[model samples]
Target chain A: MLILTCPYCGVDCDETELGAGGEAHLKRHGPGSTDEEFESYIFQRENPRGVHFERWRHAMGCGKWFHAARDTATLEVFGTYVAQAFEPPQEIKDKITAKRPGWTWRDVA
Target chain B: MSDVVTALDGATFNGTIAVEDAGLTGMITLRGDFASTSFQNAVTGVSGVNFPGKGEVNSVGDRGLAWMSPDELLMIVPYDQTNAALAEITENLGEEHHLAVNVSDARAVFRLRGNGNVIREVLAKLTPADLRVAALPTGRVRRTRLSQVPAAFWFSAEDEATLICFRSVAEYVFGLLRQSAAEGSEIGYF
Candidate 1:
């Protein structure tokens, strides 16, 4: 029973209480994008060896998107934090803001 | 009535003891740096009960009380006593970065005695508290879970321990207890 700390819930609960979705930072194509683009996004995955980003679900408590850093080789989870509710660093923010819901890249500040 | 639900909507079985809506008790969750003198004084002034302060219970003339945690405590008293307790507490500390939350409405407590040992076994299957006398010696409190419910389990008296649940989930919790008990058997809990 591994005690995984939830960034949002702020509790060290059993891993059974959570479900791993997949790698985080997986980009999904927008509606106007081509089918090929979406397919690549859906099927392709980067199986990193260390410090990989992943998405986890809080099955027993509040359901929210949270990011975590895990070492692939050791399976040691270093830290977990809530997903950015707003803007992030310049690079990631630019990419995300470009494809945000209801707004195009040009629409974001 | 075979199944008597209390005023708080908690179901009370014929064999189990129930004390519902006993009084509007005030439960204040206190959190601050444990090593801070201000925090210590804040607790003392409010309860007149010295901070057993680290991880234990300290009583104050049967009214004000403090139950400790890792870095926090739960101060409980009669509802009417909160204003005065708060007054003395704030007066002593003046200004500090601490939390004093009134969680009175969030919890419902039960006096689970008589067959406590049996109940403890039933709970051990789901909770993490070690009910063994050696592990959780009498008069001790341990915070753990009940299925999915977060609870504070403690021996409140010689043969009694209080089971507190969130107000919104009290009814569901009561049902869970009834289902866990087998039919045609006695609740011979120690």
Candidate 2:
């Protein structure tokens, strides 16, 4: 069972205690955006085999949603941050870079 | 007039473990900034127990507070004293960004006690939390699922725990507990 520490409640919640909220930090493309942009925003997802950012809610624990940076293949979570964050924190990026050198997620290099 | 009865009102079971309804305890879900001095003072005034930190439980006499989350606490008091406690908390908090909800009827509580290893064995099957004394200890509260159902539990003593779950699934939770306890007896768990 994967355990992720909830930043709000300080509990290392088992996966059973959490609910996956899909990709994190997606900029919503609404009415003003073109059809392609809207489609990408709603339907497109990066199911990369390496580093990925996702949203998770501590459903059974704190009931707060948070973000996690993890390796999709290994399921090794690099870090977890509060949901209010717009992007993965630099320290988390640095940690991921240190482990998997030359890895880049989206525009955060 | 219709009489209201709890899910476990007439239910009784005997085995190596003992389980019983806590019986209409007053429960309030309080949400606010835990670091706020006013919030702390208000809660202490009402519950007589200081506000607990994350995963902690504090009690003074029968009134108690269990930290449900970073900004949430579950207040437990005698069923008859719920209104008084609620009023005291609401009055003292003043205008803080806070919420006080009477959730007494939304939950069902069960007290469990047994000899060595019995409680541990039963809970181990249901939760991933480490039930050992070194990890959980007394006064540690855990908000986690018991099997597939969401529940909150705390160690009241080394050999005792209090389990609270939504009233809707109280019977199912009780059934699971009874089955586990009975199975433990068969295997000489304690």
Candidate 3:
């Protein structure tokens, strides 16, 4: 029963009203790249227990996509931002850092 | 040309709240940035009702508009004036980046009327959205799931509301409303 507010519609929606779009902000490696690069791009994912960023679609509401930064274990949603953002805003990162201290985002972020 | 017809042909159901098809309403889906003067002026210039704020619906009698999304508006006009209004909106927008299309026949509208909290109770059954008077007061619109289907509804009066859904799901939504509003189904939570 996780709830996330849609940055686009400004409505707080439960998981039932939204569809998860998997991990967000993945760098795609296209043709000419090495086989390992392509493989990592397609299959690799971070399964951290703490603060994670993901894409979600407000399927039942405004029918728009947005990003959510939350804890994978506790389900505490730190913040939601527009889908077009290349990365989560500084405020979201700060919130995550404040909630889960020592969670380095330099590599993951 | 064939005469236009509503999906349910003016269906009606009487329960705790009266639910009935609102007949054919001229609807246009206008998608564009509200920040643009041409976008704002074009729609307001033809819709009678000015551009509404987030999740707001501005309607007076036979005409109005609903804020459908961050960049979309649903213009409600007389059934006969949809195309004309769309044409006028397009002309006004000129070369602006926008989309205005006649969507009157692609959807269905319904009216629910009752006293005090009955309308709210009837709607609270199907969706997770807060439908209390204070949250969804008259002139405000909410777009959310009505059961498993996507729908949008607006409170026109304290005791009356209008709902809109895709034409294909008119019967499904009508049935859900009927069952939720059944005489013995009052939840009294609102």
Candidate 4:
């Protein structure tokens, strides 16, 4: 099982103690947005094989949601951060860059 | 209020490990900013136990306080004192943005005690948390899953653990614990 350290509780919770919340840092598109934007917001997701960002909740621990940067295929977690962040922190991105080299996720550098 | 019955109702499993229902108790889920002095003071005043740090547990007499998370704590008291404890906490919080939920009826607790690695052996099949004495010493609270069910548990004493789970799944959790304890009796072929 993947061990994820909850940003809120500082507990390295196992995957069984967490709930996966799909992709992270998605901008919600409502009312004024075009159909394409709304569709992208609701349905489209980046199921990348490597160097991906995800939202996970320590459902059985802290009950707080957080973000994780990792290589999906290798199961190597780059880092975990608070859920309030709108984007992956720069330090985490740099770590990912150092490991994966030239890897990028959307607007995150 | 109707009479409250425990999940096991005094049932005891006599095996290498022993599992017994902790019986009905008052359980309050308190949520607030742990950093807030007012919140800390309020909880201390009501429970007579200090605000436990992360994964810590403090006991005063028969009442115990367990840190569930950064902002949440679980208070265990006598079953009959549930409402009074809720009122005391509510009155103590004053204007703090917090929640004092009387969850005594929503959860069930069990105590596991044994000799010679029985407790650890049974728990290994359930939680991913390290139950070794060096890692999880007595008085350490862990919010982890027991197999497929979510549970809050702690090492109340050496070779003993107290596990609390939702009332709806108490039967399943108890049965799973018994099954795991029973499995300890069999010699592994591997």
Candidate 5:
């Protein structure tokens, strides 16, 4: 079981005590009005292999939504930060030193 | 007062044996000022279950119990010992910084245990508590939402893997478990 750090409760919670909020922080663009845009927004998914950002909810305990960084394959959690906070954990600094696709300093970095 | 023994209706699951008030168990809700020394001493003196100076739980004997939070603890004792336990704590602590509330009436419990996938099937339909042995391990306790009702989940040291849920939610929760079991079998689950 993964220990999810609840940004609100300030505690590491068991995975069983939480629910995933699906792909985290998905962004939307202006009125493209095209099938590709709609499909990419709804059906397309990015199953990242490395450190991925995601949103999680502490369903059974405190009802709070927060961003959690986890490694997809090994499930090694990087850290969890409050939803409103703009800064990422200091540990992610080196890993995100360079930019990648679908990433912004506001997101991946 | 006359002892009332009314059959608690819809308070259990089907195909699973349930025994209520059959064994000795006690439930106590301790609400006190965590900042007050009197409150701390009263709890430690009563059940030998001291507040978690750091963690979320602390215990004295195998049976003595205490679960931690910011300012409250839900304590448990053997069935016959609840009243005396509350009274002693109250008398010693006085009414300065503590209040020993007997929640025996508000709370109740049912122990569930059996061989086969019986226990697993029941729990799968009930709460989100991980039934995985590695996660919960036997004897570990967690207070969580079971069937959307506030309750506690613990592994028992019995021959069969035993678990307990709140008595008030027994009926609905049990019915759901039975339904899930039947649904599992209907889908060819053994």
Candidate 6:
């Protein structure tokens, strides 16, 4: 029942109209990487109880893929952004820090 | 070539609201940079309407321009003139990196009429979209699920809405709409 706005179509789509794409910002370690690196890349993912970033597709709407940052614990959405972006925008990161108070994800705070 | 027949062969059902297969509608799926002047010009040249804002559908007669996404627009034209209109835009676009394909045959269009804004109630039964007049008034199009199928609809008038879905599921959508609009099914939430 979570309403997440699609960055592409600008529709506030609920969970039913969207398809979840697991964790976001995955970096693939290819053939040249060590076994552990490949294993971590293929299997490891952050499951923090607080703020998290994830991918969602507007399956019933514009058929576009986008990303959303939300709190896992409170279910409050921080923001949504385009999938093509490599990382969260400065403003969204700032918003996350402002509300969560000392919250940091990877090297991005 | 052959005489064109819509998916439901112009089926009509008179429930709480009038549901009818709108026969054949020419739809062109055009994908390109909406910011491109060339794209804008070619679209307006054929559809005779300005680029609509996000979620807006600017339609006149058989020609309409609807914002389907950030980089995509759905052009509605007369069924008989789909090829010509597609050709016109493709030629006008020239070397622009774009895609203009005829989707007329792949989709079914439905018209829901009557009951004085109760049409919104009928549609609300099928979709999760906020069907309140303020949320989905005339000129605004919503792409969402009609129960289990993906459908897009817009209000052409306060008492009427036009719905479009894949041709393969035309019958399913029609059944869903007909049932939603069945007598005594009216739920005045709009």
Best by lDDT: 6
Candidate 4 chain B lowest-lDDT run of ten: B181-190
Judged by DockQ cut-offs, is candidate 6 incorrect, acceptable, medium or high? Answer: medium
Residues A1-109 of candidate 1: C-alpha lDDT, one tens digit per residue: 4455666545554565566788776667979889898887888776655445677875543445676655576766656766663322355344434444232221223
Off by over 4 Å in 4: B183-190
TM-score of 6: 0.96
- Model 6 iRMS (Å) reads 0.9
- The CAPRI class of candidate 2 is medium
Per-candidate total of colliding backbone pairs: 3, 0, 0, 0, 4, 0
lDDT tens string, model 4, A1-109?
A: 5888888777778888899999999999999999999999999999888999999999887788999988899999999999999988889988988998888778666
What lDDT score goes with residue B3 in model 4?
62
Candidates' RMSD to native? 10.7, 2.0, 1.5, 2.3, 8.7, 1.4
All candidates' chain B TM-scores are 0.78, 0.92, 0.97, 0.92, 0.67, 0.97
Residue B72, candidate 2: C-alpha displacement in angstroms: 0.9
Chain B TM-score for candidate 5: 0.67
TM-score of 5: 0.56
lDDT of 2 by residue, A1-109 (tens): 5778888877778888899999999999999999999999999988889999999999988799999999989989899999999999989999999999999777776
lDDT of 2 by residue, B9-109 (tens): 84656666788887778999999998899999999888888778778999766799999988899999987788888998888987889999988889999
User: Where does model 6 exceed 4 Å of error?
Assistant: none
Per-residue lDDT of model 3, residues B1-190, tens digit only: 9987899898899999899999999999999988988788788889877779898999877999898889889999999988899889888888888998899999999988887598888888999887777777888888889999999998888878999999999999999998998889987887
Candidate 2, position A58, lDDT: 95
- lDDT agreement with native, every candidate: 0.59, 0.86, 0.87, 0.84, 0.59, 0.89
* lDDT of candidate 5 over B1-190, digit per residue (tens): 8552312432444345333322335767777777888787777777786565422455444344544344557677765688998888889877576556766555555556454345554665556555555555455555556666655555554223433455666565545555654523432122
Arranged by TM-score, best first:
6, 3, 2, 4, 1, 5
Proportion of native contacts kept per candidate: 0.00, 0.73, 0.48, 0.64, 0.18, 0.61
